[model samples]
Target chain A: MSTDLSRVADPGSIKLYTTEPDHHDPITLRSIGFWLYMMSDIMIFAGLFAAHGVYGDAYGTSKITAAQVIDPISALFPTLFLFSSVLFFGLAGVALKNNDRKEVLRWMTAAFVVGLVFVLQEIWEFVKLAQEGAVPQASAFLSDFWTIVWAHGLHVIVGLIWMAVVLIQVLRDGFTEAVVGRFLNLRIFWFFQAVVWVFVYTFVYLMGVS
Target chain B: MAHHQSSPIDHPEIQSASTLQYVSAFVLGLALMIVSCIITLGGGLSQSSTLTWIGILALIAVVGQLYLLFKLDLSKTMIWHTVSAVLTIPLVFISIVVTMWMFQYLEMRVMVGGS
Candidate 1:
């Protein structure tokens, strides 16, 4: 049996038909890989939350202040602030896409300041809790509490660093195509912080108060 | 992997951002957070009911964020990430539910005076 190979080419040109799919270029691969990494991060959060659900109330024979140490009012600021940062970071993404260099930088600076305020408030919260004698080593629940919240805090810190790098690069290089991927990834990272905080507020803080 | 000739600006995800979406998500998210605080501190609901309401509100907030901020949707290119993110739900539910249940039974049987 003979197979008739069909090809479309210019005169005196040679081209072969490819049966296999084209490989993903670096850009596509970068996004897919980053998304997969984020999925794994989600799993880590799930495990931590499970630990919290399991041992969150294991303070036996010890004075459990429970929710009294955490002020609900204080918690609201961080949520609003971080969510606002997430919103501003998103606006930065829009600016980046629109090729507006200065606007992207401005949005990023605003996001950074708002995000810093959130981190500082969180630090203040931890300090107040420590002063109230509800340190990480207070009990099993506090251990889980500090671990999860700090894990999130660590992410926020890293996000701040990444945001700074992206901003600096954009400042030096302008909003070229080369920087879009990095900026987009930072947007995703910032959004993840807000998402995780929702879980923290729901499971840990709200439940504690309840 | 298939390279279409569309410009990068024409990509759905890149151009999906909007001030309306952002502000709405922010306001709605802020409201949900405040509502949670109020339910907690206002002493309107019982303990279990408060937990339930807060969880429900959180789900609403997360769904809103996923839509407005992340711009996740069921489009051809976006569905991959969206499905991957949503796939973790079963894992989270199972992990939290099973672990909490296991420990709850264990404590009920073998211990006393759980906080």
Candidate 2:
């Protein structure tokens, strides 16, 4: 295998840089593979979303409905904060464009902090819901609601942990090819979270109330 | 991979990042969300109309965010990612829509009067 590391002319989507496709480029392979995983992950979410649609009004044996439990206007706060985190992550991508490690770290830290706020708010929302007897055990409607929303929250928490690890890696190791590749994949993950949230707030909270 | 040290900036994906795009997407998303909340909370519209508006706003938010933040454009660096992501849309629709349809039909046949 020729070790010529010249930039690939065709510019495969996630490739870092390589003229020849003879050997597996670690970053490129990892990113493309990770994205495929994300696609499958989204399909799982689709199933959950579909389940929610079917069980949406199944408030069996309970007097409460989704509107009684979820407040669409109040839900906007966490949504905005989550969107802010995405913007911060995108800014980190721009920082990466300039290869400015300090800027990247700063923006990533900002993203992490904002993301933390979002997760905390969501946890509080769930806490309040549980306190109001809106637990997943309450009804099929609440079950579906909690399941889908919790799934998204779990991903956010995982993303935050991943962000912390990436921040530490960037601080300790600087921007090595591996570190940058991991950051790239994390960016995609973070962006995907916001995309899913758009649907959650729209389909679950907004339309649920309506 | 270890022998060749390259700046991450040189990568086309990173190069595609635009501060302007991200900022605009954020602003657009925020504006749309506020409008949606207003429409939902104001109770000025019927339930169906409110649902329709929310769906429209959500679609706009999705498209804006996908294009700007995810950079799912037709550019050479993003074409593969874009194509793959787009391909999944139909599957999402089929899964969600088919399930809803099945349940709706079941309700009509099962219940004396449909919900």
Candidate 3:
């Protein structure tokens, strides 16, 4: 194809084009971007999960297995806490729909509190496991267990921090487009964490014992 | 931007939020969790069967959360989000399922005393 010299000369008329669909709405863009990030995050967790599946039952020379180290019954409490946290966060979304700033803060605080409990409960469970000779160094199974669970725990901690930041922004600046966008993105984030937790609970704790 | 200026709450992303759906989703998840927990703890089924049950429950919970919490719907505002998510479904299966299959074979062929 011959070069369009005249088009190049008129730089102002040289309109750049892209193959991707035009996404001009900031709100739509924000959500799609966040969902893409969540997909990447899911891949990270997927790798951890696969690693866990491989090493989960690999007790090696040790007599301890995943069932011995993990207790689904004890995990039930933290699982409930995490689920309730998601529920409260969803309620916060409802509050945002009504533009009830105070109610939004209230529901979000509830979400944060329950989320904190979930994290604390997880740490406590890990501590107890470690005390019972189930440290990551003990066996391949324990190593995988700790790695996956702790990975999820770290995400929860980050989610909590993000939740706190959004709450503060709403309190200080009111609900601007940016703040609301952040809130909506965080909604995806918080829900994504809960979904990850479901798998972790199932494959790690429940199926560990199964 | 000035012409579009309005309450952020009026955004369709916010307007579609539903408390009832959220509550029901949570309850559904809890029910699945409870049932799986009982079956797992009771040891009524074989290991493979128990694993299968747990897998089914987890799948249901994930779907419920995607539908209710994330609003993966066909509405005007949510359609793109839904499409992006649906596209990722294959990757999700490939990542977890394919990895498990590969590792299972490696365990049998390479690991000593593997079944």
Candidate 4:
């Protein structure tokens, strides 16, 4: 209880955390809420996947098969691009941890560019499929494919916008606590997209072709 | 800095990022994609077996990203994330398996052969 100052701080010190003096860790809810949203997002994808499972091969005497329409190899390039984005984003996450503002910005730019390419490639695929008379109305199989894949594409676009906003926040504000929370949730969102894409590649591309 | 106003980076849940692991995970995922393409296009395996191998490889890739990228171990920091992610697992299988069964049953009951 000495009032005298000491340069020597206690070793092995730890403190219980609270977000605000009177608010019980409202920050944790930012992440947890995003986590829950991701769960519900999973259910949305699950419904789409179920539709694919049900209608994918069940062309119901229609001449079109998923195999004839989908180019599995088209997905591979986008896979490489998007997964690389994830890697870059992971690097950005580390940079954010170190509070290296420049590194965070650099890696985030890389991630955003790569993600943009992936989205462009996806759009290209959609155009080609549409020109080939493979619109959603063509078959239940096509309907499910377009719905599920476009749903994912929309998420990626939203993620791209979120990332842009967060990137600006980081560039403008440095690693403030609020910025960190948004970035963390966006990391989860970005990562979950990659995860969902893996399944899409396997089930939609590889399985569709094989 | 005041004791209560500590850095968010100081939190126990925020593990130091490993560049090597993240790169390795990326490489592993890319390798799996190549292998899947080979399996499908190389004419090595029958279609059924190709699908099976691709499924296995995809699972490996998913688990790799979760472990390497997200650092989703059962560490104290990852408990909530781990639990929430785990909660989605059963739902995935249920959606897939039940959909397959129901569709197969529906096809059997209603439709033509091999369309």
Candidate 5:
């Protein structure tokens, strides 16, 4: 086919054919920023894990071993909650891809609820352990145990609050680009929390019990 | 850019997998959990060697879940995740092992001196 060179040379038509890419792609920037933040947080967990590992058995005289300190039954519920939240967040991602704002909000809300449940379960577990004489001050193992687990629990609490704020924002403004970007970042954060929990659960509970 | 949006269940990547794959993964995960629980609760495997093996198995199970359940691809972006995870595991394990060893050594020295 012969192309119309004259038609393509129209100056006004050329004005509509600009090839400049949009520079305001906040989603890409936010994703990269969130990944950086996750890496930093991973470093923080690394530090805590190292600290706990080094000081875990400093006091060897205590009757409350790591096995005795961790209640598997109490931990199981929270583990389930956190894992389910990851699934719900995956659902939220799907909802966002489909441009379903209502479903996005619904899944996010479910995730937030699950997160809250996890935090509460953790709190209860800690309290029960303390009441049963597994106090942090009782031994170095207990101290390190409480510190690592409590730090993770605090992260869950913060994540729950973050989810709530994002939920409110989405409810008020719907799924704007900024909101979706933040939502995606928080989803990554939530998944990272779950990832860390697997280690904590394995090392602290499983290894401790063994 | 051409936008290719598809429902999660209808997505080609997800749809290509047989349901049995998912079911088997879930069942295997549950089995791992049970095995971990048994080792921990059986109260017969408290020695350092047994615990070490249990820990290694638990770590493997965690990796398995990440691969099977989450389907985390080892793509460019995921390389960092894998690297950090691998590095962190050794760091944590070595620290714990060294500390426990030092503590036991000190206890032995104290006993010898007291005798």
Candidate 6:
């Protein structure tokens, strides 16, 4: 038998039909992928929370409780900065949708600034705490508190880098489909960080106050 | 090569639909952030029970933010994602509570016995 060269040579004639487009919806894929990454980040926080719970009362034969170490007044500014960062991310999302490249860059730049401010506030808080004899090794409460808060601060730093990357992409490509998809994904991730911060501020900061 | 007749990005309806989503996300995110700030600072220092209530309220705000900011919903395409998040969050909460409770119990026991 002659080799079936016709079918093999004319692959385009095979007529493979499907309702969906050949390319995956980049926005959807990016959204889902970023979500998965967020879940993984949540797991990291969960681990820290578990550690806090385990060592919550182990203040090394001392009476230093959670209430004594945390300063609610000092926490307020960083919380405001984090919330503002969320708003900036929202503006970036709006800019992405409007296909306004310049606005996207501006919003993301604002978000980065807000995030940096939050990080600075956190460092100041830590320094003040340390000055007040609340070092990480001073007591179990201090250790757990620093671990959880710093872990979150590290995440915000990573998010700022991610935003910077997206900003560069927008500057290079404008509002092209790839850039838009990436920006949306970054927005989702950044918003998730804000959500986690809400829990951190409420349970960790506010609860520690009383 | 011949040019394509139509592009999905050029579809006016699809363009408007995505724009609406973006707008909604912005409005909802801003509202939730303000609400959370008020709840945290406005709620004066109180007992554990009152603080717990505030925490619950903050959690609600976070859910709203996630829904509007990320457009995370339990649609068919996103069911698994929603389910995993819902389940995992509760697990994290329970783990924290139980661990803290255990530590508190042990501390109390040591105090009573040692005294």
Alpha carbon lDDT of each predicted model: 0.81, 0.87, 0.86, 0.82, 0.67, 0.68
Question: Pick by lDDT: which candidate is best?
Answer: 2
DockQ, structure candidate 2:
0.61
Candidate 5 chain B superposition, TM-score: 0.56
Computed on C-alpha atoms, the DockQ of candidate 5 is: 0.19
Q: What TM-score would you report for chain A in candidate 6?
A: 0.82
Judged by DockQ cut-offs, the docking class of candidate 5 is: incorrect
lDDT string, candidate 2, B10-64, tens digits: 6666677899999998898888888888898899999989988899999999999
Residue pairs with backbone overlap in model 2: none
Per-residue lDDT of B49 in model 5:
63
DockQ of each: 0.56, 0.61, 0.54, 0.52, 0.19, 0.26
lDDT of 4 by residue, A1-210 (tens): 342223235433434575566542434567778888999899998888888877778675568888888777767899899889989998998887777889999999999999999999899988988998888888788888899888999999999999999999988887777888798889889988888998888888777878
lDDT of 1 by residue, A105-203 (tens): 899999999999999989988998889888888888788889998999999999999999998998997754456667767777888899899988878
TM-score of chain B of each: 0.87, 0.88, 0.86, 0.87, 0.56, 0.58
Location of the lowest summed lDDT over 10 successive residues in candidate 1 chain B: B1-10
Question: Which ranges of candidate 5 are over 4 A from the true structure?
Answer: A1-24, A60-63, B1-31, B43-46, B64-115
Better of 5 and 6 by TM-score: 6
Number of backbone-clashing residue pairs for each candidate, in the order shown: 0, 0, 0, 0, 0, 0
lDDT of 6 by residue, A34-115 (tens): 7777777787888787776576556776566777776666666676677778777777766655666687788889989999
Model 1 Cα shift for residue A198 (angstroms): 1.1
TM-score of chain A of each: 0.88, 0.89, 0.88, 0.86, 0.85, 0.82
lDDT of 2 by residue, A82-122 (tens): 98999999999898888888999999999999999998998
Worst 10 residues of 6 chain A by lDDT: A22-31
Per-residue CA lDDT of candidate 5, range A6-121, in tens?
66766555565558874534554565567666666766666676666656655666777765676664566666777777667767766766667898889888988888888877
Backbone clashes in model 3, listed as residue pairs: none
lDDT tens readout by residue for model 1, B14-52:
677788888888888889888888888889888888888
Q: Please provide, for model 3 over B1-115, each residue's C-alpha lDDT reduced to its tens digit, 9 standing for 90 to 100.
A: 2225366677777888898999988898878888889999998899999998889989999899899888888876778788878888888778878888987887678866463
Query: Residue A7 of model 4: what lDDT?
Result: 22
User: TM-score for every candidate vs. truth?
Assistant: 0.89, 0.89, 0.89, 0.87, 0.72, 0.76
- The fnat score for candidate 6 comes to 0.28
